[model samples]
Target: MSWSVDNTADRQVECDSVAKQVRSWNWIVGGQYRLVDMMGKGSFANVYSAVNITDEADLVAVKISHEGCEDTLVAEAKVYEKLFGLKGVPRARIYVKERRCGALVMDLLGPSLGNLKDYCGHFSLKTVFMLADQMISRLASLHSRGYIHGDLKEDNFILGRQETIDERTVYLVDFGLAKTFLLTNGEHIAPKTGLNPCGTLRYTSLNCTLGNEISRRDDLESLGYLLIYLHRGDLPWILAESVVGGDEKRRLMADIKLHTPVKKLCEGLPDEFFAYITYCRSLRFDEQPDYARLRLLCEVAMRRLDYEIDGIFDWTIRLRDDLEWKRLLALEDVF
Candidate 1:
């Protein structure tokens, strides 16, 4: 199903149905991590706003797999095994229950970049620069550890700890699609042909959509699109009403993405944005990405925007941090 649904009524009904189903799920996962309430539900699993009764002070998100969907949860757990202690990644622990079902316990994070963007309508140039700097660094850090965030998107980069010492820290989450792009021998993995796009198609790189192996550049390019969205409030090709038919609509969106001139896309934004696109586009699938250079470009963009990296973004100026903490605690019992 396409995310670009144009019928407001249908969309609302679909969302409501999903929300009701999510709200109805009150099962305590594995007799622990009591599912306090729903957080979000995806195709394969449901995430709950949960807390360990033994450690109530620290809230957590518990992702429980659907009965028959254990494999994905297991796969994600395996990825987390490789991702533990990695910088910028949220701390995750895996648990298995009866029937081979699984659950993932991880840090309770704040609004995602997508959530923040929706709240603010659009981000300031300074905020975009800061996000770019942090996201590029996060992707670089993950890539250096030999894994590529195969599903890099605005939603996966979430805000962390606005109240404590680690304020404005962005944490990358959801490693269910990550892949080891580099081998332990410090060599790039051999490329394969005819692979389908592995991430969110809209923000996914053109090469990725055309059956290319996932790479560091694809992650960076996805970040580049997210920065543009945060700045402009929309991508150039997101006119949901511009076409008819789901399959046709998806193809058109992909075609626009493949054909849109990077210069045109970044016309009103900073030249650094265009530079990001050019750099990522020029990279070969097996090439190592120069994350330092990308991060430096973002730093320069901040200078060009008459802002510093130290300033607070919209999310940093929280709606109410304690309100969130209280909400988690006060959530109605579903389990």
Candidate 2:
């Protein structure tokens, strides 16, 4: 999970195939990362793995964008800066290299769940349990702080570095579509009636697709889809082909989400899956979800599957030996 290396002239980008989209942003190239290697691109931004010059064993990830996309990165940087001291989120200290181009730097994260899924198919039950617990806890933290991660999908949840205490941790990245669903005074934002689409299509909530303003419930609902996707590797409503227009496709997705029985979607999964969907669906537009209950539900599933709640996960399974990390530190010594 840790990406520090000496003479990183070619430290290599992980998940190159799945995260191949990259563009050259010509600002802040000499600072931050000693070697700015492209990690991958998301729906709207490019990521890079750069060596922190002070320490080869310690590297930082820089996310940059240019032109019209600059504002989204600016907004994302603001969210990271504003949420300082917020655990489970990424590094609170975000540095801006070129404010005009939205070039920014923060602590590097491990592989995204999206890249992992594409490489290894569905996550194991143990991975899902660990991810589900962390995700719900983080979602609760974000909501408690008065923000909705308008975009909640596997790609946004990246693993923490192996060398850090957050090794078992999964940090939720990309606050591009984040919004203050609740006002400063604890009052909800004014309700709207229309389809103002937001976030990724696969995991967006029905309310957001219908043009309604997203709220806490919308985020939790999206989390529901994320959990299912992690469990099954695909959602039931994901169409086989784009036979219809974008609007129509979303309509069918939303309809199938509504019409399809929760039991069917969660056929081979545990009871927690159904509970999550049912609870998310039943939430009033302005209500708070029971974060503890949802996480506890996943805990039950973990027990049913005979997985150790605190066991190391998919990525860290190889680093269990002391020699692995020792070898990494040795590389630092030689450098």
Candidate 3:
């Protein structure tokens, strides 16, 4: 649906009170949604396509789990509810029902970026910068609220359609590992470990591998790796080769963390795009770049790439509009 300012108010929902315990949640099936078919499967849950029974016109992705994972399921539901309709990301249309079979409902997304890459091979440099700009803006929005996406990778991003560039929308999905940064008297501290290093290994940065403190910087590192994969069809390290506690893996990661070969991979991209990727990879435990700087870079790169890609004759605009962007960024100030 075309999200406009008129419909934006209807999208905002309170996210404070969701079921915290799974055993306490009642599993209700067939209440308001008719299961269409299985969409995808995760390590813990099965995502399905379903038509909302209450609103027959609406279709959603429902997650079902019946293992000893009630609590985790409930936690994921709560996070999605709170984060649904969040700007720059795919807003979750989440609801929990109590019945014989419990279910969690979320908005459906099209093919993920990983799948897109698999089907279409590599994308142009212009598309990479545009996507990178969108990602940077989304990350900035999440970080401003002190919330870490926890998982950032190609699989979590979806393409809305395959038409013109302006018609395509990159929807950031899956927030099962998301967490809000809690502040005590205005001080920001590191998120504790044991939070399940929640991200794809291929895209995960060295900070996560080292068990170093998790912060916004960790997400940025992964974003950088994703951009590289999208533009160059390669990750900084191979998953099988980058396992923790392995000698070769550790050494290779150490070298990458110390100095990522930005010049080599970003061979044909614009100078600004290279600079942004460099900044993302360079972010350290104590020295993550401020969101303001990243936002500025994204804006500049997006505009530059737009001119280069669109040229003077073509007037096809990107699907992502400024109003939604500005409104989403405004959420940070309130936080």
Candidate 4:
């Protein structure tokens, strides 16, 4: 199925029903986490907003696998462990396997870039540049750890909550599809073909759609598409959504992305955006990406536009205004 936003009210109703059933059993995970509400749901797992009753009631996200899907959660937890202490990666508190399912507890984060984009339609160039800098840094860290985030999409990158030191920091989450591209001996894995595409079709790389084995370059290519989407609010291949059949749709998307000129794709945006995509798509299968240079492209764009490297983002301003409005309403009620 295509990646579309579900009706929030309907989803919440279903989540509430499941929450009630789980609460009735008085299930306490990680010895002290009590699931308070459902935060999100996936094909094989559901994420709950929980509180650590034994740790000063700190909030955390608890991901529990559905029946017969325990292995997925367990494997994802292992990936998180490998990414521990890495900037932009969330810390996994604990992972436990019960008779029925597996659960992983991690630090809670705020709304995703996708959610913020939906709230504001699109992002300003300054906001996109700031995000590009952090996102490239995050990818560089993951690549250094020998892992590649196979799924690089807007929904996977979220900001830290407000009124905290991390509020300006962006965190990458959902590593269930992450894979190691480097072997133990420090050699890169050889490229292979005839593999099924593994990420969201909208942001997946052209190489991936062509059944080629995913590598570091493919990850970077996907990130380029994501940045473009964030700036323009859409992509050229979005029309492929109306096509019937998953395989046919993917084929059409790949064709469009392959034939679409970089100049046309990044039309109306800064030249750096076009250059970024061109560089990513030009890398060899096993070549190491120049992460530093990639980040420099964004910096050049920011300077050209006369935008400061300030931590303030479009969403930051919007969120601040929202909070102030709420405070005013509260004072009016009190008076």
> What overall lDDT goes with each candidate model?
0.75, 0.73, 0.61, 0.86
Give lDDT for model 1: 0.75
Runs off by more than 4 Å, candidate 1: 1-26, 183-186, 240-247, 318-335
Instruction: Quote each prediction's TM-score.
Output: 0.84, 0.82, 0.70, 0.92
Candidate 4 lDDT by residue in tens digits, 290-335: 9999999999989989999999999888888999999999999999
Task: In angstroms, give how far residue 48 of model 4 lies from its true place.
Answer: 0.9
Q: Candidate 4 regions off by >4 Å?
A: 1-23
Clashing pairs in 2: 194-211, 195-210, 195-211, 196-211
Model 2 per-residue lDDT tens digits across residues 136-242: 89889888878888888888888887566766677887888787876778788877876546787678777776667788888888888887888687887777225
In order of TM-score, best first, we have 4, 1, 2, 3
How many angstroms is residue 9 displaced in model 4 relative to the true structure, after the best TM-score fit? 19
- Error (Å) of candidate 3 at residue 325 is 35
- RMSD over all Cα atoms, model 1: 6.2
Best of the candidates, TM-score:
4
The better candidate by TM-score, 1 or 3, is 1
Best by lDDT: 4
